[model samples]
Each structure stands twice: as structure tokens, then as C-alpha cells.
Target chain A: MSMRRAEKQLARVTGLILLALVLGGCVNATVDEMTYNEPVAGIGESSVVILGRRHKPDYDTEFDFIECIGDHIHSGDPSIEVINEIAFINQFYPWFEPRTAPLQPQTIDQLLQLPPVAARFDEIKLEYMIWIDGNTENTESTGSMSCGIGPGVAGCFGFGTWGTESEYEATIWDFTDKVEVGRVSAQTSGQNYMPAVVVPIPIIAPVQGTACDSLGDQLLEYLSAHH
Target chain B: MLCFTLLAAGCSTKQVVVEGNFPKPLLDPLPITLGVIYPSAFAEHEFFDEAKGRAESDWLVKTGEAQVEFWDILFDGMFDEVVHIRDWETVQRRAAEIDGVLIPAIGDLQYTIPTHTNVKIYEIWMRYEFRLVDIAAIHQQEDGALSFNPDEHLAAWPITAYGKTPTAFLQTDEEAVNLAAVVALRDAGAHFVTSFGATPDIAVWLDGIARREQDAALSSSDDASGPQPIAQSSETSSSVEREPDSGGTL
Candidate 1:
């Protein structure tokens, strides 16, 4: 190979290394978990339903996540019946105004009094109910960068980074025992880099999806664990 | 900055809750049907910032709901019905039934600088006015309604308490205020309870003026023949319409 070609190759490799170094270290993800009650054998025969907290408006946007979690639970234990969200809304929630439809019982007494929710519990022979609520927020941001390949030499434009944090917690409620079974919490946060000259290059992490994945796995383990 | 004056410290508000520390047992079951009138405005202090000229923290409008709660909890068995006066018209109309009214006010307040550093201090002076007015004794206005005369029968008590948090206390300025207020209010409340009943000088006067009337026996009562029906056992709430202020008046 000619020395000119060799030098060009070396320059490209060094530029790539420099670009890698330019991106500062991203934050690591963290998680916390807690289990409240001892596991019992009867959950295997009982059906389950996942309900988003009523107060938060964003829970409506998490239908896909609910389905994803339901799929994972069903895959983990095929016999465990997972109620469909659409069916729940149509058949059960129709009894009350849109505002009053709540699957997660505030109190055992409230559950007994709510005819529609009680009837649905009887219909599905529900055992465990999972209440999910969480939020993803951009907590902090810093640094700006602009880089590009101008002619043969790489030039810079502007570079910057911002942090994104995802936090989710799922609580399992047992109807038979009239108690909270356990809780699974997951959180993921990292900073992503964006550089632009003519075009912008971004390295964004799937923070929300990653949290959902961790929570789903943890919920499976919590439900299936012996004690 | 000229804009940041000594009043600037009064801008911020820190919520402080003083837990009960009353060790005095009820001296006597007075059973006085008392109505609580929380203060309209306690003392307010404008605190200074780092510059000692900028007013960064100020005690603004505060609610006396907590005071009502404290009074009820502290003097639980002492009064027959510890009603919080919400509707002044209604409470005043039924005022004839109440034996006395308790009014609480914050008198004075002072704070030190640099809670994060050395030489931090907090102090509060609280005053309570307990008026045991006899409706029949007070004079009537031109409209024929009974006029409340403060001179009729009133007891005023002033209490001063201090909390000092040195640099070693390891608390923020806001935290120092909270901690200091907690200590001061708790001490003031406990002191009030003791002085209201336990003190011989005050108890003798209070006992002579106020006495709970026992329910007379119904002629057809199953146990009416007995000496008297136990008024203490009666769970019936007072017929007096009790209420609280609508907004944060105190």
C-alpha cells in the first residue's frame, strides 16, 4: 500500500477515536425492588388484570406497555388468564361515568361496594391485580458540540448532551387475601449525545422501553417466586 | 441590590408542625363546653438573606387549623365539646350555650442568621386569650344582640420559647426554622396546658368560675331513680353548631 493511503487510513482511525472520546461517559441505570407479602400457590389458577392509576392523564398513552406486560405474564404462565383492556372498559367500566371507572380498589370495603368492579372480579375470578404508575422526565442537560467532515479534515459545528430518566412502579394486589402482594420498581437514566454540522447524529437510549422490560421481568419473578 | 431589602427574608415560607409534649394530666374534668377561635393573624417576620439586607424568607398568611387540632387533642377530656368556630354568625348565635371561648395568637418572632454556619437562633413569643364570658352578664347593643366585652372575664397568657441550632446542628436555614419552631410551639402548648389547669393560682380561679351542668334525670328513665345519669357517658354531641374558619385566617 502507498504511504499516502496508509496515512489517510491512520487519520480516519484517529478521527474516529477522537469522536469516541468527545462523547463523555453516560450515566448508568439504577433500580429498586420490594416485596410485601409471601407468595401463595392459588395465584396459578386465578386470572389477572393490569390497571393504570386513574389520576394520571399519561396512563392513557401507555396502552402498548400494558399489552407488552400482559404478553410477558401470559408467556411466563400460559394458564394465568390476563384480561383484555378493551373488554374491561366495555363490559365492566360502562356501569359508571368515565371518571369513576377504577379497577384498583382504594379499600377492601370500596371493592365490595362497587357492583361493577365486584362483578368483574367474580366474572374473571380475579386473583391478582397490578396497579402501574410512573413517569419519564428529562432531569438535566449539559455540554454542546458541533462536528462534521469538512473536505478531507473533520470540522466541528456544535455538540450537546441531555439526560433522560424513566421511573416505573407496579403494585400487585391480591383479591382473595384482600392485601397488597408486592411491588416492583424500575428506573433507567442516561445522557445522550447529539452532534451537528450539516446533519445531526444522535445516540439515544430506549430508557422507557428498558424500564418496562426490567419491571416486567421483575414482576414475573415476584409472582413466580416461592416465598 | 436596593430591591433586596431587609423585607426580602420574609418572601419564603417554611411549614413547621409542633408535635404535642403535654405531660400534665387533666386536673379536673371541668366539662366546660368551650369554643375555639383561632387567631386571625399570628406574628409575621421578614427574614434576611445572606446579604443581611435582602428579604428572602417571610412568614405570610398562615392557618390556625393546626392550633385547633392541638387544642382539641391536648384538652380532650377537659371540655364537654371542644368546638372550632367556623361560622361566626352561627357560632355566635349559639354562643349562649358555650361556657367560654379560647383565642390563640402569635405575639412576637425573631430569627438568627446563617443556620448553615455558627450562631443560629430562633425564637417565638405566643399569646393566648381565654375569655370565660357569661352571656347573661354581658351588656346588650342597640340592636339587642349581646356585645362581646373583652373586660368581662378574660385571661391572657404570654409564652416565650427559643431554639438554638449551632453550626454543628448540620441543618439548612429552612430546616433550622422548622426545627426551632417545632421546639418552641411544643413547649408553648405544653406550658399552656399546665397553666390552664394544673397551676393552683389559675386552677382555683378557673374552677370557681366554670362548672359543667349534669343532665337531669328523665322522669320515665329506666335508671332515673338512681342518683343521676352519668353525663360523662353521654356521647351526644352538643346542640351548638360548631364550625371552623373558611380560609387561612390565622
Candidate 2:
């Protein structure tokens, strides 16, 4: 082959390799679900509430993840009504506050025995309450990038990578029966990359988003299933 | 020049004004007219902390508006009628018409940021001193039946509340701190409503009011049904001893 032809072939190979790397970043997610009681059928008129556990002093289940799960479940099944987290919590006020929220199904039953609390719950027609606990964190990280500017020229040249993990569990409770229905959990890990050659190109791994999607999908399946 | 400007901007004071809507608590109202006193210091409360290090920024957090709003809603929901008094003088002047008076003051306020804790979170803590004044006692003094003494007709207690917000989604430290403060204020309101009339001092004070009302009702009633005992408020009221107001310190 001629020199010009060889150069063109080498350029094509490099482009294909870069495209593959950009399209396929390192991401892994696992989802598990267990059911203790059968879900009630005909949930068209009932409502579900998704709440984040915030009692931990070190960390809290992020609100955005809860919202993501709500949105996903609603999208999956339009018949199921999802209540806004803030609005539902505010309607109940102190009973559902961080410090006073019921941590167990039995506690919820006792709270419901209160006339005022029971009246409000009846008004809302709540059926299912999902308590989400866990958070995304940077488990490990290595490498660093540096940028410098001198005289008339300025640019960045370095490479860095960081690992992130997200683990979340959704505990579903049957509000009408006051029993633990089931639980669905998702664990996800990913590595992010940054390569700087004059201009830094970041390849971000969607660790949290993947975890939310997996948990949401599993939760939707668990709720929709009867037996 | 640009670096100097950036440094100056970094050193500028961060002012956070807490703002949010506090919901009315769902509970049976205590059957009593309450006179609320919002001292100027409590109503216009602000916390200021100068940066201790070069990397830190000064914070001036104004929580007065939210404080007044939260307490107003809470008190209005908890009592049969809530009367906002401008000062203690007003409470003294109209002591006869009111059943009791409530005065809330900030004892202490503290906060933390992600840089300080290395935990990517912002937290705020508040201590509130609440004084429940017996209007009947004040009314007696006002009627010239007894000597006027400010400390003789009151019971005071302290409540501590805490709140925190994660910095993952927040774009700025000011926003995080503001959110944290709002959460803390809401927490304070929640604590007040759930624990009111349960604290040892406040419970005894409430029990005394209940007994007085019961006696008054029995004397004035021609029939058997005089108001029933407040279930939650008077449950443990008689069991606890009332603590004297020791210089208004809890």
C-alpha cells in the first residue's frame, strides 16, 4: 500500500476506537427484590408516597433519587398515582418529620390509631408508603489533572479517574393493612475518566442514575405483581 | 487584577435569609386564650460568625422572618385563640382577658458547613427558651390585690432542635445554609408542638391551669357538662413538679 493510503487507514482505526470508548464507559448495576405479602390489586384509585429516610446523622437518602423513583414508577404504570414527597410530608407535618417519623410498620399502625392522623390518612386514600434509605458516594479515587497558563498560551494536560458507588433500598409498606409488603434494592458502581490534551474531555459515569432506574424498575414490578 | 478581584469576592460576607412555609400542626387545640409576646430580639434574630481562617467566609444568617412565621402558625394551631403582643408591657396590660402568655426567645444558634465537617453536609442547631406566664397571677397583681413582681407568675423551659442538608445537589454554600436553617426552624416548630405541655415545667404549669379551669367551671356550671380535661396536655401534668424560673435560664 502507498504511504498516503496507510495514513488514512490508521486515522480510521483511531476514530473507531475513540468512538467505542466514549460510547461504552465502565458501569455496572445489580437489582434484587423480595416480597413478603401479596400486593393489593386495583390500585387505580389509591395513591403511593415515596419518602427518603433522613434520620441518620452521617448521611441521608437523597431527595432527587426519591423523585426519580416516583417519576419512573408513574411512567411505568399510569394507573398508579404518585404523591409528591414534600406535599405529603407537609400535610402530615410533625408526625412524618425526620425525628418523629414512624420507622416500623407497627409504629405506623399506632400512629394511625390517633383520630386526627387517621382522618388525614383517610382523606388522602393512601395505599402504599415506600421508605428509601441509602446514598451515593465516592468510594475510591486516584489520579489528578493539572492546568497551567504562561505568557500568551494557556492549556491543560493530564489524565484522572475516579470510582463511584451507589446503594439504595426501598422498603414498601401496605398502608391500608399496615404490614410490610416487600423490599427492593439496587447496587451500582462506575468509573469516571478525564483526559486533558489542551482541552479536558470528561467521561462521566451515571452511577446514581443507573441505581435509581434499577430500583425503580424492580419496585414497579413488585407493586404491580399480585402473587 | 483579576486574581485580586477573585480573592476579594471570595472574602465577601455570605448573607443567608431563611424562608419557607410552615404547616399548621394537626392536633386538638388547647382550650385557652394565649397571648404571644415576640420580643424585638427574637423577632429580628440574626446569627453572625466571622471567618476563622483565610479559606472560610463570614456568614450573616437572618432567620427572624421565618422564626416569627413558624411560631405564629404553630401557636395559632395549638391554642383556641392567639393574640400577638408587641412586647411584655402589652401582656401586662391585657393580662385579665388572656388565659396565659407565651414568650419564645433564642438562647443560642450554631451552624456547620461541609468544609468544617468534611462530610459534604450543612447543619444548624438552635436552642429556644420558652416562658409560659400565668395570666391569672398577673391579673391579680394588676388589680392591686398583690405586689407586682415579674418573675412570680411564670414557668420557663428550653427546647433544642437540629436540621441538616446535603451539599450534593446544592450549587452554592449560601443556598445550602439557607435550606439547613429553614429545616432547623421547621424542626423547632415540630418539636414545640409535639412536646408542648409535656416538659416538666410546662406540664405543671398546664396542670395548674387545668385545675383552675375545672374549679371555675364547677362553680359556674348549672348542668353536669363542664369542659372535659385536655387529654394529652393534662395526662402527665399532675405527675411532674413545676420548676421555678431561675433567672429565666433553662
Candidate 3:
């Protein structure tokens, strides 16, 4: 090929490669799904309330996970009642902190004896109450990330990968039985890669959704099978 | 390294509170069963950035749980009598359990640490918003009784504390932010103690009872020619009230 034609071919190839990298970098995804429950029947007409344990600096991503569970449950069984955390928790948000553990079975039992289902999540009959607790953390770290202008180099630079772990668990109870029923937990880990360059590109592995969905699906399956 | 350091430093959790022991309640320690609903915990507030002319969030964060604990402790120290923390929903569902409710919101939680070397001053401030609502009126409303039109039934106040420190340039700005919180909480608590009034219904109802007693005594004296009852001034009789419209703090 002539010099100009060869240069054009190289430009096309570079464009295709850059496009592929952009698309691949966009997917900083992680997931881990698990469940431990046998399905039962005669749970219809009863309601389920899903709650999450609250944390410092609550992220909007939390709602995404919760809504996903609610959505999946409805799709599985429209008749079954699913109360979102916000409607119940925010209604009394001052009192019922979100994502926190529910009152102990003893406390719940006493309150229910005096007045059935004192959680007051809703005025209806609730059989299943699910409490969720989880958070994300950096499991390990290596190398360093820095941004500076020295000699001929400028902008940002980093040459290392940082591992992040997302851990979560859900504890379920049958208030009707006034006993502990089941607990589901999930964890996912991945590394965020950063290559030294003029403009640093750090691939982040946001596992909040992954962990939430994995547990959500399992929780729904358990609820579905039991119902 | 500098940018990473800054980000790491910026991400933190802090509890803002009055440093020293809370002062004694001055006004006979009106010991009504007080409860706070959804009191702010340590977290970023968007308003802090709004005040600082920034659009980003997480710039100002607070440990709201600290505030909740501080309020619990401050009341324990300030009040000579019990100040119970009623379950938020129980109080809402059964309004009679609580004497009054304080829903608190916070602002200006972040410290302003200028990034540039030329800017030498760093400042921090916090604002507390208390929405004080009367329990009786809420009960009345819940009972389908005619509701008062924002009259003596509700009052809101904003309390703020400010602090300043020379640009640290290199040292952590946490010190300055914390100092500001201490000052803010102290000042805010004092203001709350002196200004927070009983629910409007209680104040108004009590005021009516006092006035009737005074009038009856005056009439009885006028008829029997009894020694004229000592003149009772309105300010001295009804000083417990802090209603804003009548030349009072709103």
C-alpha cells in the first residue's frame, strides 16, 4: 500500500480498537447469587415487607437494589403484596430506620400479643418480614494512583489494581410463626485496573447492584416457593 | 498524590455537638415528655454546598447519629425531669404519648477549605432546623376537629454556629470543621433551651385559664369591695409563650 493509504488503514484499526475498549470499560459489573429454602404453599393473601439495614452516607444505589427486588417479586406473583422500604420506612422514617434489623422475635411477639404486627409497616396482615444488611469494601490494595505534571509528563497516572468486595445478607422471619425462618447472604469481588497514562482510566467494579440482585433473586425465589 | 489525598481526606464521618456539659434548664425545667423524630445523623447535606456556591454533594457530611445521641444526652443533662424518647410511629399513631415533637434538619455541614494557596482563610458552619409541632392540635386534627390555621399550633426555628481557622494548606481541616460544630451545637442548644416553647395549644389553653382566674378574682373584689387584687401584668403572666406574630420570636 502507498504511504497515505497505509496511514488510513491504521486510523480505522485504531478507531475500532478504541471503540471496543470504551464499551468494555463501561461494564464494571460484579454478581454473586445464592439461596437456601424449600417452597411451600398457602401463603397467598399474606403480605411481605422487605427492609434494609441503614448505613452512614446512604447511597441512592440502595433504593435501586430494593426496587429491583420489589419488581421481581411482583412479576413473580402479582397477588402477593410487596411493600417498598420507602413507603413504610419513610412513613415512619424517624422511628423505623431502613435496612436495620427488625425488632427481635420476642419484642415482636409481645407487641403482636398486645396488638398484632406492631411494626406498623402497614395496616394490613403481614406474614413475612425480610431484613437486609450489607455494604461494600476494598478487600485489598496494591500500587499507587497519582496525578502530576513532571518534566514532559502531565495530567494523571496510576499503575495498579485495587480489589473491592461487596458483601450482603438477608434475614427472613415468619411473624405468624413468631420464629426465625431463613437467612440469605451474598458476596462479590473484582479489581479496578488503572494503567499509567496521560489521562488515567480506572476500571471500577461497582458490585452494589450485583450483590443486591443476587440476593434479591434468591429471596424472591424463596418467597415464591414458600407461597 | 495530592488529589488522592484530598479525596481521601474529604471522605470522613464526624459528630457535631456542644463540647462542654449542657447548661441547666432555666425555666423551672418544664419537663414534658419530649421526643425527636428523624433527627439528623452524620451525613452529607446538599445545602452545605448550596451555601458555598458549589453544586456537588458529599462536600459536607455529619454523623447524625452523634447529633441524636447528643440530643439524648443534652436533654438528660439539661432537664431536671425525664425527657423520654417515644417511638416515632407510636407517637404518630397515638399522638397522646408525646408532649411535643421536634423534627430536625441540618445544613452547612462541610468546612470550606480553599484549594488555592492564595486563599488563606478556612471557615465552617452548621445550621439546625427544628420543626416544633404541637401534639394536641395534631390529635385534634386527627380526630376530625376544626384545625387552627397555623395559629399557635406550630413554630419553626433555625439555629446556626460558625467557626474560622487559618488555611491549613497541609494540615487536616477536620479540626476546623469539628471546632465549628462544637460552637454551633453549644450555641444551638442554648438557643433551643431558651427559645423552644411548649406546643401552642398548651400555651394558649393555659393562658386562657390564667386570664379567667385573674378576671374572676377582679370581679369578686369589685362586688365585695375587697382590697383591690394586685395588678397582674400580661408580660409577667404569659411570658412562657414565644409566639412570633405578636412582637415575639417566630
Ten residues in a row with the worst lDDT in model 3 chain A? A92-101
For model 2, the stretches where C-alpha displacement exceeds 4 angstroms are: A1-24, A149-154, A225-227, B87-93, B136-150, B223-250
- Docking quality of model 3: it rates as incorrect
lDDT by residue (tens digit), candidate 1, B133-213: 332223334443323445434454555544333232356555555544544444455455445665454465466444433
Proportion of native contacts in model 1? 0.00
Output the better candidate (1/2) by TM-score.
2
In the order shown, the candidates' DockQ scores are: 0.01, 0.53, 0.01
**Global Cα lDDT for candidate 2:** 0.78
- Tens-place lDDT per residue, model 1, A5-98, is 8577557544643563565344455667787664545366667877654333222225556777787777876766788764554344222212
lDDT of each: 0.53, 0.78, 0.52
lDDT of 2 at B133: 67
State residue B246's C-alpha deviation in candidate 1, in Å.
39
Quality of candidate 2 docking, DockQ: 0.53
What is the Cα-based lDDT of residue B108 in candidate 2?
99
